[model samples]
Target: MKVDWSPLKHELGEWRAAGLTLPLWWRDDDAVAPTESLARLESLSATSGVPVHMAVIPRDATRSLADDLSDQFIPVVHGWAHVNNQTEGKKAEFGMGRDAHAARLDLQQSMARMRDLFGARLAPMFVPPWNRFDAALLPTLAEFGIDALSTYLPRQTATPIAGVTQINTHIDPIFWRGTRGLVPPDDLVAQTVALLQARRTGMQDNAEPLGYLTHHLVHDADIWEFSQQFMQEMCDGPVRLYRHDTKGFS
Candidate 1:
C-alpha cells in the first residue's frame, strides 16, 4: 500500500520505504573570513550529533583549520582559489566557467592538491562557487577524481561521469543577491519550511537528503545565530538526516 504522506510522517515513511539515508552538509564557501563561520560550524557539528562538512579553499596552501576540526566536522576542498568568472556569461560558476581546456586543467590541479594534503579525508565532491556550473563541465569532474558533485536544483540530465553521484540542492539559508547580508529571520525560516514541505508530499525525487547550501561570507549574522535552531526544528519536525553513503548516493 502507498503510504499517506504528511510532513514528518511522509519523510519517515520514505526513510523506511526506500530505506533512505539522509545526509545533511554544512557549507561555508570562500575561506577569506574564517573566525565566525568556523566557530558556528564547530558548534553545530557538536550539537547536531551528525558529521558536518566544511568546504575549504586552502589556496593559502595551509591546513590550519582542517587540522583543528575537533573530530566533529569533516573538511573537503571547496576550490583551489575562490575566484570570480561571472563575466564568462555566468555569475557564480568557477571552474565550469572556464573553457573545456581550462576547466579540465583546474579540475586536475584541484584534485592533486587535495590528495597531496588531505588524502582520505578529502571528499571526491566539488561544490562550485555561487552554486552554479555549466552542464558541459560535468565530465571534467571524473577526470579529476571528483566522482561526486553537489550543485543546485535542476540537475544535469546527462550524467557527466561514468560512476558518479549527483547531489544537488534546492534550499539555501541566506538570501543572497537580494539582501547580501543581514537576512531577515522570517526569510530563512520560510526557506527551511519550503524544504520541509518538499521533504513531504513525495515532492523530492528520491531519498537524497533535503539539500541546503550556504555561503558563510555572504550569509547574514542572523543566519549563524539561527542556523542551528532551524536545523533542530527540521529534525524535530519531519526531516530525517543521514549521510549520502547511507542513501547509496556517495
Candidate 2:
C-alpha cells in the first residue's frame, strides 16, 4: 500500500520553517543472537543515519551478538528471559502474577550480564517484553541502577518514577494482532502525523523525543522498506538524531 506522507511532511515542513527540531530515536526489540536480520538492520541504520537501541534479552543473549553491533548500536536490557508468565491475560514478563522480588533479581542479573557483554555501550535502560509491566515495579528500577524505562505510547510523565525517566515509542509499523506484517502505510503515516500534531499543539509532551519502534527479527520486506524511507525522510527534515548517552535520562 502506498503511504500518503503529505500530512507528516506538511507538519515536518512547519517545524523546519520554525527552526524546530524533533529528537528522533529508533528502538528494535527482542534481539538475542546475531543473524542476517540484525545485519540488515545495521545496514539500514548506517544508510539512514539513525542508530537503533537494540533491546537484548539478557538470559538468551550471547556475547557473540555484541560483536555484530557497530558503534551505531546501543545495547539496552529487554527483560530477563522474554517469557510471558501471565496465564490468562495479556502477555507480560513483569506482570503482577509474578513475584516482584524475583523479577527484580532477574533484572539485576540481566543488568550484570549486559554490563559484562556490552560494557560502556550499554544504555542502562530497561525495556519490558511486549511493552507490558506492572506499575509496582517502577520504583524498584533506580535501586537496580536502571536509569531509564522504555515502553509503548507517549510517556505520560517524563519522570514517572522520580529517578527513573520514561521514554516511549510512538510509531510501530507492525500489525501484531492481525497480519503480523506492516500496518497499512497510510494509517501509519496518519498516526505519526497525529502524534506530532499533539506534541506541536501541547496535547502531548513536546520535550519527549519521537520514537520509532521495530522488531528486526520479525520485520517483513514492507516493514523494512517503510522504516528506511520514513527514517530517511525525517533525517532530511527538521529531525535531530537522538543518542542514548546524550538525550534521555540515562
Candidate 3:
C-alpha cells in the first residue's frame, strides 16, 4: 500500500521552523537470543544511525544474545521472565494484585541477571512486561540500580518517583488486537502527526523524547519495511536522536 508520509514531514517542518528539533529514540522489546530478525534490526539501526535500546527479558536471555551485541544495540532489562503472575486482567509480569515482596525479588533478579550478562553495556532501565507494572513499585526502582522506566503512552511526570526517569514509547506499528500485522500506514502516519501536534502545542510534555516501539521477533515484511522507512524519514528530518547516556536525560 502506498503510504502518505507528507503529514509527518509537514509536522516536522513546523518543529524546525520553531527552532526546535524533535527528540526521538527506538526501543525493541522481547529480545532473548540472536536471530535473523535481530540481525535485520541491527542492520537497520546501523544504517539509519539510530541506536536501538533492546529490552531483553532477563530470565530467558542467553549468553549468545550478549555475545551477539553490536555497537548499535543498547541492552535494558525487560522484566524477570516475561511471565504473567496475575490470575486475571491483562498479562503482566509485574502488575498489581501480586505480592510486593515477590515483585521486588523478580526485579532484583532481573537486574542481577542482566548485569551479569550485559555487564557494563547494560543501561539502568526497567521495562515491565506488557508495559504494565504496579505503580507501587516505582519508588523501589532505585534500590535495584534502575534509573529509568519505560512504558507506553505519554508519561504524566518526568520522574515517576524520586530518582527514576520515565520515558515512554508513543508509536507502535502493530495492530495487536486485530491482524497482528502492520497497522495501516496511513493510520500510523496520522497518529504520528497527532502526537507531534500535541507536543508542539504543549498538550503533552515536549521534553520527553518520542519513542518508536517494535517487536523484531514478530515483525512481518510490511512491518519491517515500515520500520525502515520510518526510521530513515525521522533521521533525515529535523529531529535529534536520543541515547541513554546523552545529556537529554541529564
lDDT of 3 by residue, 20-98 (tens): 7788999999999999999999999998989999999999999999998897899988999999999998998888888
- Top lDDT hit: 3
Candidate 2 RMSD to the real structure: 1.9
- Output the number of the TM-score-best candidate: 3
Clashes of 1: 3
Could you tell me every candidate's TM-score relative to the true structure?
Answer: 0.77, 0.95, 0.97
Q: Tell me the whole-model lDDT of each prediction, alpha carbons only.
A: 0.59, 0.87, 0.90
Error of 3 at 30 (Å): 0.5
Tens digits of per-residue lDDT, candidate 2, 41-130, equal 999999987889999999999778987788878999999999987877889999877887788888789988999888888897899999
Give the CA lDDT, 0 to 100, for residue 214 in model 3: 99
What TM value does model 3 have? 0.97
Candidate 2 Cα lDDT to native: 0.87
Superposed on all Cα atoms, model 1 deviates from the true structure by an RMSD in Å of: 5.7
Give the range where candidate 1 is weakest over 10 consecutive residues by summed lDDT: 1-10
